[model samples]
Target: MDTLKQQMEYAHNITLENCRVAKPIRFTETSSAYGGGAEGLSDGFAAGFLWLDKLGLAAKYQVTHLFRQSFFGGRYALVDMQLNPNPDLFLSVLYKRLVEGPVFQVTSIDIPAQLRLYAHCVRNAYYRTSWSTEVVRFGGDKQTLAIMHLFHYRVSY
Candidate 1:
């Protein structure tokens, strides 16, 4: 995970450094992945997990925008060619609901590599204050033992 984070950060820095003249550096055709063949990435929850990880990583890197390729076509498409929604689509929606405010710092101990965690908070825009913590812990392989903690804080503003 650290290596992946470093590689993404390096690429982002290089783009910014090289595109100084442009008002904004742009990256195009970002997809979760491809080459899963006609079956569309994976048969079930595996594909959804991959996408959920990618979505979290993208947010961590501060990507201006991302395109989930083949929303309704191609082998890695989120929806079937017949317009049926897949598991990945539902995962995408869940991520969408998660990231309402800016990502914040989280500290944990002894977290297994297979289990990944992400966090954000709900902010009161009218007063510009954060009131709640929303942490999402959803990633694991066959060998991983997963335990999730949902923390809610009632802050007196």
Candidate 2:
């Protein structure tokens, strides 16, 4: 499936059939880098958004582990040899820090068809703060009304 919706459906069906044992599912090489050189680093924002969505999907499917193939040295590496972090690296960090909560189903009437939204609760280790951040990521050059959305959802105890 070329679209995220299709990918999510595929994953959901597969998980329903094969997730009985809770066995580890390894999602490796989650980078957008294909070859080497500038092209490898060309994924930019779209890639980052896709990566974040993939993480959410993985978590929704109860994926045990998600690994990034190349952190450095590769064309799609998170940082260059000098250790300066790339744009996607920050997204990776955000995923790690904010995605500790169990995945929950969300429904939105306002979201456009082309846009995607993913939500997760704050990790307990963090402070007892309720912060809701709405991120709007424009897809492609069209700059359509539909875009990517990342929400830090909260539940008060």
Candidate 3:
């Protein structure tokens, strides 16, 4: 996890230096560490996604594979050969449904390294008024806890 963070930071720095205008930094392909089952993979993926979103380092990311096929192997596939959804697939769906763009800065002091918090605009489809969403992640051995809080308000133009 530390190594992944360092790589992301390096990439962010390079992007800032080379581009006159801000360009979205994307992770084309990524997956959890090896030797884990569906649950572990889901936890790791969720943690990584939350970390990236919290830091605003990645505008987008793609998981390694969607289908468990021989060509790409079945290790990190989101679905199995029988087309059953993996645990991470649910996480992906929830993320898409609940989170919107324009990541907000999160300030914290004396927080544990395994705990992460991120804020974003709530998906407009879910509510008529403006709303903010906060996602909290606590990672532990072989498990992760994620909580989402929504704040709603009206904005007059």
Candidate 4:
């Protein structure tokens, strides 16, 4: 309908086409756990963004940033999501329905991740989660407060 929408549509088409065209014959993983790599980002986060981009949701959600954070006045856990359209909405978040462990402050950006790929990051020592699926980690302290980034765009005539 408008310039932004048009661009989104075009980008969506390109992403889907590229995914289908490339059709990753196999899945390969480069773990940041071993040796050295990026920082705080994960292979899955990267893959997930690629897949979401292919599905056209990345643009819709404007998932510019994602990560867990201490929220509810530092009483509960939250997800600090950020987008280009509205950066403020990207405040401390706690999207997960089930929050494990106590709330805590952000100690460091990426104390344990090879590549920062999560939505929010803090040193595990400062903030811990017992939930196997609820833990937030970074490869190292090099990563930014946000986990990872997935940039997008489109041009039409």
Model 3 error, position 107 (Å):
0.7
Query: What lDDT would candidate 2 get against the real structure?
Result: 0.60
Q: In model 1, which residue pairs have backbone atoms overlapping below 3 Å?
A: none
lDDT of 1 by residue, 62-136 (tens): 665667666766656777777888887887776675455556555567765655555655434435544334333
- Which ten-residue region of model 3 has the weakest summed lDDT? 62-71
Clashes (backbone N, CA, C under 3 Å), per candidate, total: 0, 0, 0, 29
Compared with the true structure, all predictions reach lDDT values of: 0.57, 0.60, 0.49, 0.28
Please, what are the lDDT tens digits per residue for candidate 3 over residues 1-157? Answer: 5565577678767867898976666554454434433444534355445434423334322122222222233545556566776555555566667767666665645445764445566788878645444443454554433332343333211
Best by TM-score: 2
Local accuracy of candidate 4 as per-residue lDDT tens digits, 1-157: 1332355456556656677552212112211122332222322243233332221222132323332222211212221223121111221122322332333222444344222122222334444543221223323343223322231322111
Stretches of model 3 off by over 4 angstroms after superposition: 34-73, 128-157
Please estimate how well model 3 matches the true structure, expressed as its whole-model Cα lDDT: 0.49
Tell me the TM-score of each prediction against the true structure. 0.63, 0.68, 0.62, 0.19
Candidate 2, residues 1-157, lDDT tens digits: the string is: 1364466557667867887754556677666545653543343555665566667667766667777778887657788677887777898787688657566565656655545545566766677753323333444444433323453334211
The lDDT, on a scale of 0 to 1, for candidate 1 is 0.57
> Which scores greater on TM-score, model 1 or model 4?
1
Candidate 4: where is the Cα deviation over 4 Å? Answer: 21-157
Q: Which regions of candidate 2 are displaced past 4 Å?
A: 1-12, 37-46, 130-136, 140-157
